[model samples]
Target chain A: MKPPLWQSIGFYILVGVIVLQALFPFYYAILTSLEDGQALFEVNYLPRALNLANYQAMLSGGVFGKQILNSVFVATVVVILSLFLAVTAAYALSRIRFRGRGLLLLTVLSVSMFPQIAVLSGLFEVIRYFGLFNSLWSLVFSYMIFTLPFTVWVLTTFMRNLPIEIEEAAIMDGASSFTIIRRVFLPLMWPAMVTTGLLAFIHAWNEFLFALTFLSTDSQRTVPVAIALISGRSEFEIPWGNIMAASVIVTLPLVALVLVFQRKIVSGLTAGAVKG
Target chain B: MSKTVQKSRLSRSRTRSAWLFLAPMLLTLAIVAAWPLGRTIWFSFTDASLDLMGEARFVGFRNYLEYVAWGDGEGQYYGLLADARWWRSVWNTILFAVVSVSFETVFGLIIALVLNQQFRGRGLVRAAVLIPWAIPTIVSAKMWAWMLHDQFGIINDMLQTIGLIAEPIAWTASPDTAMVAVLMVDIWKTTPFMALLILAGLQMVPGDIYEAAKLDGVPPWRVFRKITLPLIMPAVLVAVVFRALDALRVFDIVYVLTPNTDATRTMSVFARENLFDYDKFAYGSAASTLLFLVIALITITFIMATRMDLEGKRS
Candidate 1:
């Protein structure tokens, strides 16, 4: 039997509220980014004006442009390194029968749970020892604390689900484990790769604590830190308009990825959680 | 050569290759994670300053004792324990985790239930819900801060216009409402995550079970309570554990939106302040170590309780 009219209406209302809650702040950010100086402080819910001054001001001067580039480069490098390491390790963990494999996987998971503050002091010493303080490499190295474990876990789950016959056939042809992984399994793993890579990229991109702690120079900071430390000329004023604009600029790419790869991302997320 | 000899050689080569494949990742993890974690524990016992030139000396458990002890009849506590702000932060962190995770789980269940229905534009709705999760935490914090601004924030304006309040309230500034404000932003940001995870669990409940329940004229709520909930409990537990761990260490949202205010300082913000801002390096290390231990204890307990397989197989 059909549900009553009020129940249907309630369901739709709930859906609408969820949509609004998810999108309103972001929608408002875009609107705020578009408003000029005087209009910036207005409490209007809708877009009041079309202005590019904040965006222009943010991009033109300061290290905002370089910071964006640094964020991109850092996240990209982390993804590549994480995926490479995760792939080889995932192959070994899933395919090879080995002792202590269970313990190894648990150790990897535990590493991901280490709070950045827990490692902050020691990592500071490590960075300084490597002469990477206040540099882009510091963020890259430290982010592995999070990104690597997640990638390995998700990729191992994906690898285990592949058919055994394929690997058996490859082995029958005298394919080494590496050769089988490269020629046989890698072809079937692109979707998993994309999902894992995108998640890693987002994690590295959104990471704030380490970025805040590791990089001190204005130009070397990533997007999150740069936006957090974005300020007005004097000590008294904070340039909210410029900060919103920078926030929008940094967030847009990730939003695009989420929208385009929504299905894969959901699967990737569930694969990581439900399986664990 | 005998067949067993060849088999052993092949198996040995596979083991060697497995180690080879794992070497780089393990080594990277060692240098980046293990070494620093060990050093952090060591530093917790020493008075190592953030300043590179400061003299380092072993202080034993003085730092840890100060973190948990009261002072000698002087109307004060010693160490981080003595600092009212530190206790406030610890309380705030626990409060934030319990309240925010509870909200996320409830709202997420609602959204997941709604999305689990057969509907048009379900895919689009799923993608739209991810927007909040997709936004960077700093950006989300900034966005909410602007919208929650007492003077010109849309939230205050809308609340007043709707006759919800008589006057504007300073959300992040005041001790009374600061934690509430942080919870609102966190729930908004993470509810989608909770929903998606629950939705995944919901999808795993086979349709035939629902059909069977319908055939027996079982009420929807009954079906949900008896069938859906039990089936989804594992996923829910996993989601809760992950979210709790994340929320317990929350630093960016509180730091960006409210700064150093005691109203919203978390353990992380508290510890980071000691480490970097106050130069109480050993003290901060102890605090950090304590935080790690709390989280590690929770994680270990959860793993052992659930008997979860790392292989992700259904066993």
Candidate 2:
């Protein structure tokens, strides 16, 4: 059942267009980053040079180096905290028969759907109250508002599918529920944990509004904010090449994660979303 | 008797641990999400400004009046209701959401359909499209901004080369094309998300149904309309609702690409300005509360519709 020749050609052309639309921006960014100074002003489809000076300059100068470190530290802490809380709660909801579990899970899902702006002012108050303003801990605290619900939901879905016999066997051996979860269940839940953790990491990595609001100083800014506020020394200058360089550097890890764990990422997304 | 006693102990401890396990997470959420949300609602009723945080006196309906409408008679209205910029932002948000979500759905369906077919290099193409989704929104906005630069942007160059425009257009700078520029970036970044969701939906359709339709010698479009569309409608609806909700609160792309422009300011951006820049905390809270209500209404409607659809399917 091959398509007609013309239709096949058309299909390929459409596919080509989709791919180009998806990749062109980043591709163009790379091309721009490679061109320094006067080369950036020209509209070139292909790379005219392969210069690493912008990347070198971004890393060597200013606080971008610290910003990348802050992003990593914050994102890592978020993933750890979110996975820890979500796993325990997911266990309670999934394995232990409990009243109001369904309603509770639905509530958790709805919390993730909250628009960030809706919580901004109050969150600002909360951050100020905790004395966490301009600190990485503020991001760690604020990101949970989003990361927890999603991890909890996805992990609950995963835990619900595991066989009951293992837990029962552990119980027959007089093992505690906590013991069973730590020793037996955690071993089986690695794939789910990995998928959920990675998704949480990516969410924390890409979050902009919260990052932008909570942190003010150059030393406290995350990679996204750093890239956003990347400006030239002069008021009129934008320094496009340096911005593109920083963008590529920040995006490489995310692209690698997506490529390597493509299937797991997709499953985690559908599991978290479709179940809603 | 011993077995039953052991089982009882296990059940009791399990309940205890369950509560124990849920406590920290629930407390964290209460402090982080629920409490802040409650405070936002409370703040909406006051005249709190950032400069005088603790001095906020309860001014019943004052903030609301100023946010919505507060003026003497003689056809005078002040507040957001009187503010043309606020209305323009609201319009821009709705327009952006509706148009972008509609296009994303159509393109997502087409992309999903294409990707659903068994073909060579499918995996490569799938991975390629995900690049946009993986990049940060700010990064993508910056990238698109460069590409849409009036004087030196490649997009303008290509358009000019192709004779689509007689001159290089200042896309983000011009009010007429600002919304269009934002939509292009949003649609580009988000269509992959819609496609992935719709692809998941497409995978759920049983092959036998399609086989039966084909056996009847149904035209392809008829098969698609009758079988594919109906079966995938729920997933598509879910994707649409999600995208629409997201679009309604869109801040990053718009804020990054077309900052300070009335033509592209969204509800979120409008609220943020009052809260942060203008130091009108209570006014911002009112705007935020309104935004929250709008999102909540849409979500409730979606949930009700989904529930009814499920019950209808059951019947």
Candidate 3:
């Protein structure tokens, strides 16, 4: 049952539109990044010149390079800490049947949905009390509020689906719960960990509010905040070229990771949302 | 009797270890989430300034609402309740959430249906759809801001070339078009997430039903309306609520794209402004408290409405 020629053509056109709409903005950003001075002022959709001056300027000037490193450090520490805590907690939540377990899971899930602004005043006080203001550690500490719950939820969902027979066999051999988790579940949980860790890393990398409020210094700012605060010397001359170049540099890694782990990302997202 | 005792001992040890495993996470949540949230609420009841938070005095409901009477028991009201801008921000947040989520759902469904088709380069198309979602929100906001630039923007250039308008519009600066520009960027970024969620739902629908409908000569539109839509409604509804809750707290895009515009100032922005910029820390805490209450009310209502199983037994 072949479709009619017109219908097939219409379908292909729809596909073309979807692909174009999805990819056009990033393409335009990349194009705009390569142009400088008069080239930027003129709107040319096509690639005209291959210039790396904007990238060079952004990397070599100001605190932009340090900001990129700040984002990397914050996101990396956040992912590692959240994954370690979430795995142990997920093992308990998924494997053990205890009283108030359902309520506990619900509490964790609700915490993730908290509006960041809601905690701003208090978290600010906490940061000041701990003397973490104007430091990257403030971001690492605050990001856990959003990252921890989803990691636990997704990993709990993933851990529950593992085979129970292996655990039962391990139990018969008189192995402790820690040993079973270490020897039995650790190897099998790598894919789930990777998926959740990547999502956590992305969340921490892209977080703007805490980064904006907690870190007042120019060098301590993350990439998102730094990009938002990027400005030229004069109000009239906004540095769009350097901004786009920095934007492209930070986004390329995330785009590559998403493309490569497309399947795992999809599964991880669905596991968190659709399953709930 | 010996077997029963052994079982009891094993179960006791399991429960103990479970608590041990959960202790670290629960403590972290208490320190980061629960304690901070409690202090935020507490600050709302006091006159805490940003610089002199320690010397703050308690003021019951003054930050939320206060009345000063000078003559004949008649005067103006002061506080968040009386401020028209606060109400406006609440309205803006709701409107942004409702409008953006609705557009994302519709566009998401269409893209999901298109991608669900058997095509030659389906993987490539799917990967392309993920691009917008993969880009950071602030980066996308900057990219769109550049493209929507009033003077040298490509959007204005293309619109002129297409004869859509006579004069170039200042998208982010102008009050009339600020919200529109924000919505455009938001829809572009979030539609992929909605589509992916719906795509997951679409995949769950068995193919045999579609085959059966095809054998019966059912029209494609009817098949979609009658079969496909109903089956995926649960997933779509869940996604909608999720996205709505997310949209209610929208800060990054609105902050980056249209700053200091009354037309697009969300509750989050308004709260943050008072917290730091306006030097009204207690008042800002009050605003933050209300925002949390709104989201919490919506979430509770949603959970009760759906009767979502907290325990993983049913699924």
What TM-score fits each model? Answer: 0.96, 0.95, 0.99
Q: What is the full ranking by lDDT, best candidate first?
A: 3, 1, 2
Model 2 misplaced regions, further than 4 Å: A233-236, B1-9, B66-76, B308-315
- Candidate 3, residue A78: CA error in Å? 0.7
**B1-315 per-residue lDDT for model 3 (tens digits):** 999999889888899999999999999998889999999999999999999988888999999999989789789899999999999999999999999999999999999999899989999899999989989999999999999999989999999999999999999999999999999999999999999999999999999999999999999999999999999999999999999999999999999999999999999999999999999999999999999999999999988898877788886
TM-score of the second chain, each candidate in turn, equals 0.94, 0.91, 0.98
Model 3 lDDT, residue B258, Cα: 97
Q: Runs in model 3 with CA error above 4 Å?
A: none
Q: Across residues B99-118, which tens digit of lDDT does each residue of candidate 2 receive?
A: 99999999999999989987
Q: Which tens-of-lDDT digit does each residue in A1-276 have in candidate 3?
A: 999999999999999999988998899999999999889899998999789999999999868889999999999999999998999999999998899999999999999889999999999999999999999999999999999999999999889988778799888888998898899999999999999999999889888999999999898899999999999889579989999999999999999998899999888888889997
Superior candidate under lDDT, 1 versus 2: 1
Each prediction's Cα lDDT score?
Answer: 0.89, 0.88, 0.94
Candidate 1 segments whose C-alpha is farther than 4 A from its true place: A233-236, B53-55, B66-77, B311-315
Clashing pairs in 2: none
Give the per-residue lDDT of model 1 (tens digit) for A1-276.
898999989888888988888899999999999987778878778788989999999999968999999999999999999998999999999988889898999999889888889988888889998999999999889888898999999899888887778798777677888888899888988999999899999989999999999888898889999999887779437788888899999998999999889998888888778887
In model 3, the Cα lDDT at residue A45 comes to: 87
